[model samples]
Target: MRNYSGVGNTLTLTAPYDVASGGGALIGATFGVSKLALKAGQRGPFEVTGAYDLPKDNAAVAEGVRAYWDNANKVVTATANGNTPVGVFTAARSAGAATANVRLNGSF
Candidate 1:
């Protein structure tokens, strides 16, 4: 295949802010999990397609529900009003839980 690049399982994204490894990042419309801790403005590997446990608000979330990235709070959220759609919750989580399992949709 001409002009083909390697599989885009991971992308190098510049941290918009300090982000810990496994944390979600949304750059414009692209969202992915950091492969390692990164300081603001640093560029690093971000896994774009995979299941990850990410921090979320204290709200009950059902499996198969779409997950949005709250860039302001840096958490996975069910709210879509002012957030970036990142992926889907692969596991239901009860209210008060600190995290939710999300499967990155890659194409989103």
Candidate 2:
């Protein structure tokens, strides 16, 4: 255990842009939920793992399907094209819904 570190569920990252608490942020290639509001260039904790209610596009999503992070739009999506894989949809989401439930996979 000499090289052990703390659990990585929450990690520190400099915000690339102003982000509110519970907002999704992508730093470099890592994506996670901000633990607190952070101004651009401020370093703070981000929860990289766990289920979350994330904003989504006007697209219906079926339960149990993989979810992707639409970084350009800052929303969770079912489309994989040009999007980063964040996790899976935990529940069905109808088109036009404001958000979708997702379980973070903790890795890009």
Candidate 3:
């Protein structure tokens, strides 16, 4: 799925459009709501980044995603470059719009 929003909070499992007999899925990803906090007198802003690869295009993937580090059966290695840093979400942040700069924020 490229980009999708839920109606209310729901737990739904989405299946890939294509899965080979034994090839399985090539890529899989997921996202969820999360919370963050900022102490008093915090500066402009900070960045929260995950260790993963950014999708090269905005296709069926690259929606609400980072990479899913799945080492199926411990066969495929997903953390070979786990130390590599990906881009951070540093924009769309509310500009000083919190009593204590603490709240739950994330995309669906």
Candidate 4:
């Protein structure tokens, strides 16, 4: 393997609004987690792809299940129809857990 530019799996983009580190960000339909806290219009690294631990809905989720993003509540749910899907749940999440591991599928 040859290492050229040395760019990792993350991308830098201007924050559309204030976002905390690890918070979800939607850039032109590309959903990702903010690598660092950023103010509105500030350029920062964002993880556009890969598995990430993110906040999940109260509903219990099983491993290998597809999860949808609830834009209004900013959480991932097991429901599919009418919701924006963000990724597949790689780990089972009990209703008590606040977050779940998700393998991001990226821009549908």
Candidate 5:
């Protein structure tokens, strides 16, 4: 499109806190996964426009269902109350499964 910004899928921003590659990074009010290891005060790119396989809570997550972020456990869950939704679960996750593929679509 003529108005397309031509920006790639990832965005570069200063890390507000230490973040490991593939780990969640919450910048200002935006949440995304760090594409590279970044220390506090460093600048790096993060993948914010794609799905990511992230850790999930101990509850089973049905395929195509929405999932929320459990800040306390640093994992995603199907629960809606008191937790911020992160994305839709792309696949079913049995209880106690280590992780779930989530199509990230959340904000701070």
Candidate 6:
């Protein structure tokens, strides 16, 4: 058997600042979600994703996360991040697996 499912996207927001003369640079970068997955036993409950941002200057890029809720809950059952850290979500190091899954509606 073979099957897979996932969702993710790259998001970016910028605001430009000025200097003295006719030269300035762009700033501001928010955490951009890189990926989300729902795979089989291939990995774990979920591989918490990270983000990679493009910077312009001293634009305090992805310093901290912007979540209304505690970010840890979403990753409580993660097995491990992945081969590569995507971005700001890159803060996500690596974790272990959650309780096994039993398709028959019983304990595994």
Top model number, lDDT: 2
lDDT of 5 by residue, 1-108 (tens): 788864656778888778889977667656678899999899998877679998888889899998777666667889989877667899998999999999987443
- The TM-score values for the models, in the order shown, are 0.95, 0.96, 0.16, 0.80, 0.78, 0.15
* Model 6, C-alpha of 99: deviation from truth (Å): 39
Q: What is the lDDT of residue 106 in candidate 1?
A: 95
Q: Candidate 4 on 1-108: residue-level lDDT in tens? A: 676754556878888778899987766666778999999899999887789899888889999999787767788889887678778999898887999998888554
Positional deviation of residue 79's Cα in model 1 after best superposition, in angstroms: 1.1
Please give the range of 10 consecutive residues that has the lowest summed lDDT in model 2: 99-108
**Collision pairs in model 5:** none
**Cα lDDT, model 6, residue 93:** 26
Please report, as a residue range, the 10-residue window in candidate 1 with the lowest summed lDDT: 20-29
Give Cα distance to truth, residue 72, candidate 1, Å.
0.7
Looking at model 6, how many pairs of residues clash? Answer: 6
In order, what is each prediction's RMSD in angstroms? 0.9, 0.8, 17.9, 3.2, 2.8, 18.5
The reply for model 4, stretches above 4 Å from the true place, is 1-8
The residue pairs found clashing in candidate 6 are 50-89, 51-87, 51-88, 51-89, 52-87, 79-96
Q: What C-alpha lDDT do the candidate models reach, one value each?
A: 0.91, 0.94, 0.24, 0.82, 0.81, 0.21
Location of the lowest summed lDDT over 10 successive residues in candidate 3? 97-106
lDDT of 6 by residue, 1-108 (tens): 255333422222221221122111112222222233322222112112322222121112222322111123321111233211122221222223221111110110
Q: What lDDT does model 2 reach? A: 0.94
TM-score: which is higher, 3 or 4?
A: 4
What's the lDDT for residue 38 in model 3? 26
Two-way TM-score contest, 1 vs 3, winner? 1
TM-score computed on alpha carbons, candidate 2: 0.96
